[model samples]
Target chain A: MILTVTLNAALDITYKVAALTPHTTHRVGEVVERPGGKGINVARVLAALGHECVVTGFAGGATGAVLRGMLAPLAPHDALVEIAGTTRRTIAVTDGTSGDTTQLNEPGPTVLPEEWTAFLSSYDSLLRDADAVALCGSLPPGIHVGAYAELVRRARARQVPVLLDTSGEPLRRGIAARPDLVKPNADELAQLTGSREPLRATRDARRRGAHTVVASLGPDGLLATTPDGTWQAAPPEPVRGNPTGAGDSAVAGLLSGLVAGLSWPERLSRAVALSTATVLATAAGEFDAAAYERLLGRVTVVEHTQAASGK
Target chain B: MILTVTLNAALDITYKVAALTPHTTHRVGEVVERPGGKGINVARVLAALGHECVVTGFAGGATGAVLRGMLAPLAPHDALVEIAGTTRRTIAVTDGTSGDTTQLNEPGPTVLPEEWTAFLSSYDSLLRDADAVALCGSLPPGIHVGAYAELVRRARARQVPVLLDTSGEPLRRGIAARPDLVKPNADELAQLTGSREPLRATRDARRRGAHTVVASLGPDGLLATTPDGTWQAAPPEPVRGNPTGAGDSAVAGLLSGLVAGLSWPERLSRAVALSTATVLATAAGEFDAAAYERLLGRVTVVEHTQAASGK
Candidate 1:
């Protein structure tokens, strides 16, 4: 079973308006709410793909309850630790005409030290039964920057291959704990490596202690590097739709393939295909089986020769 | 007792950000949640001022629960009927540097026919004990435009004064029921009257079955027209701060004075004082007694004789 940890889960709200004008009142034509957070998205896609996954994270207050309620139908077996502070909400207002999105993210609930300790204890017990773990999303207030690093260390101790996907200082700190895989989009890779070139940035990320680095380049597809070799996987083409959780879907695809014991090339192919399918799907991070099947054949994976240092 | 009805009460969420740019993501610095809807806001302020107020509205789902939870501490009494759908949330993103506010209002949850029937029946019962009733804010989905009109008629039958505060077609249709008072901001008054001029538009609004019309002109203060007189009550000077909820606070002041048996000039003075105090307060719609007392003497009430019938 795959274990997913989302420290800062959110009630994601999307509003569709004719146009978004600053300092003006807008009446949204459509509003949709869903459970959200990077790990939650990955767990949802994995569950949809018929994988056994358990999502454990901090949830509190009414918003947290609503988020959990929304997730019940999507992922039947999940554990959300109730905390004191309420979960945050992210508002995504999309312009109906231009298809542009404006996002307003609330700083998530603060997790007390005792709450973190409780989560760690619960997670350790859960990880003992899990084959792999995926630690995703931002650290909520009151959580130390090295919280994900500690989780990665615990997963390693339990012999569980962990996938870490986050950005900024959290990712910087977490990489030192040597997670099995780290997925950073092109922009995050640049921030991590201080380089614009994707190939160089992926290599730099690997050097920072991530065993495998998967760099998602929007439209250009995925660039990955491991000790075995480097590879580039490209979808047939970019589909026009909301790309909100495409990266998280890719994380789900990669983890699902790994748990199924698929080859690296096959894993890359699955990741690219699932991400493309997610973009084509109406909802973010959601991919229909037919769409994924149709896109799988179109995802092309080209392996690259390992560098002299074997990165 | 003052009865306030918010058919579509909301959890008003305010986020303070550095600035607002369309199609971009922003991390909010501060978040505040308050129970809201025009009538709810009015009721809260009235309660704060030691007035006996009852708030009746439809609330459902988790968000509605949060709204009710937050309202418990603010209102003297509340009767939030459980409905079929959740209450909506309105997000106001305020730019700290510019003091500009961008509002994104959700089309509130759909009220089922059964829910509306339940609300109307309960509301009619509540009105029997009410000295004055206020029907406020936008109608939720599945609620007819004539809902407020029906409430107005009910209040009329009981000889209870009713104030209608809303915009668009609801206001247009509700006016036919001949509410005792209609308070519209300049822009809303213009929309209702098809005249940009406040004076002409207010007169037009009064002719449309509203016995009295009160137009709130932000810094210019309040304008009211009655059968006996036309009065303009302007605060001595603009005591600047956040203008959010100033209108609702003004309504609270007006209702408080009416219940206290104050004359029109005294009622207008109290309204102006409370409105100014709200603007001076750090939070919207919250008028502290100290601030209200400080501003009471500064409010300037200018009374005008009734305009010639031809003019």
Candidate 2:
């Protein structure tokens, strides 16, 4: 079973309004809610791919209950440790006219020290049956900055491959722990490597210690530098809808492929297709299965053999 | 005991952001949650004045649970009915830069036939001990348009004074049932009577069926046409802040003053002061007690002798 951790989970809410005008009241036309957080999102994608996955993290208070309640029927098994603070919420107001989205994100509840320790115990127990573990999203307040690094080290100790997906100091620290893989979007890569070039940034990120680095380039596609070689994968066309969960979908693809022992080229193809399909899907954290299937064979994966030259 | 029915109760959530910009993501700086809806707000204000108030409404699901949990410690008694549908949430995004608020209101849960029937039974039981009842706010989906009218008639039958506060068709239909009082803002008064003139509109509204008509003019204060006489009450100075719950505070002032056997002029004075104080308060459904006291003696109430022509 694949294991995913989301320390700062959320109840993702979408409000559909005729128009989002500042300084005025609006009666939302529709409300769509879903369980959200990076690792939860990745778990959802993996579950959609018919993989048995377990989601373990910190779930607390009313919003956390709502998120967990919504997740109960899904494929991923819930192993979340209880906490005292309520989970946060993320609201996206979609405008009918301009089709633009205005987002409001509430900070997650601060995890107590005891809560963090409880989560570590749960994670260790879950890792016992896990082939791969993923530590995803921002660290909720009260957790140590190197929380992901500790988790990565633990997973490596258990001989379970781990993927770290985060940003800022956590990413910097977690990457140094030499996780099996790290997926950072272009902006996050730039922040980490101080370089805007995807290929150079991915290489710089790998040198920071992950066994492999994958950079999601939004609409363009994925750039990866693995131990065996390097490859750039692009979709047949850019699919534009909501790019909210595209990166998590790519993470799911790569992690699932890694566990399935698929070739690196095949994994990149799957990752690219899944990422594009997620952007094309209407719902958050969901990929249009047919779109993924259609784009699968069409995804282009080109390998760069000049790895030693650092080009 | 005073009873307030918020057929469509809400979990009012306020988010403070640095600035409200359309089509951009915002990190909320602070989050405040309160039990809300017209009658709920009124109940909150009444409780603050040491009035024993009972709040009855449809509450369900996780959001409802949160609302109830928060309301548990408040002064008012909770006798809210349970339903299968989740209660709604209203988010007010206050911009720190401009201090302008943007609101997004979610439609309340659809009350089923059985749910409405259950609520009526609860209302009937509560009315047994109720000296007066206030039916406030919109009718949620699945509830009949004449729901408030029916409640008003029941309260009247029980010899319990009923105050109707709503807008559009609900107000129109409710008025014909002869509620003891109706408090509409300037916009609602104009909509009900097709007159922009407050005196004429208040009289017209009273003629439709309410024994007393009180129209709250934003910043300008209130105009009341009661059986004893007609009076216009204005604050000494306009206190500006958020007007979100000003009308509800007015309803609370009027209702509590009625129970206290205050005269028309005195009740109007209290209502105006409370309304203004609510606007000056920092939190939702709260009035500045000191400001209310300060503004009470300073409120100016002018009685118009030409009541017949409403000149």
| Leading candidate by lDDT | 2
Supply DockQ values for each candidate: 0.88, 0.92
Candidate 2 local lDDT, A1-311, one digit each (tens):
99999999888999999998888889999999999999999999999998999998888899988898999999999998889998999999999887789999999899999888888888898999999999999998899999999999999999999999999999999999999999999999999999998888999999999999999998778989999889989998766688889999999999889999999999999999998999899786699999999999999888887855466
Q: What TM-scores do the predictions have? A: 0.95, 0.98
Q: What is candidate 1's lDDT per residue for A1-311, written digit by digit as tens?
A: 99899999999988999999999999989888999999999998898888889999999988898898898887636698999999999988999999899999999999999999899889999998898899999999999999989999999998999999999999999999999999999888899999999888998999999999999998888998987788899998767877878899899989999999988889989999888888888876578678899988788888876554344
Error of 2 at B232 (Å): 0.5
lDDT of candidate 1? 0.88
Task: Mark the 10 consecutive residues where model 1 chain A has the least summed lDDT.
Answer: A302-311
TM-score of 1: 0.95
DockQ, computed on Cα atoms, for candidate 1: 0.88
Cα misplacement distance, residue A254 of candidate 2 (Å): 0.3
For model 1, the stretches where C-alpha displacement exceeds 4 angstroms are: A306-311, B306-311
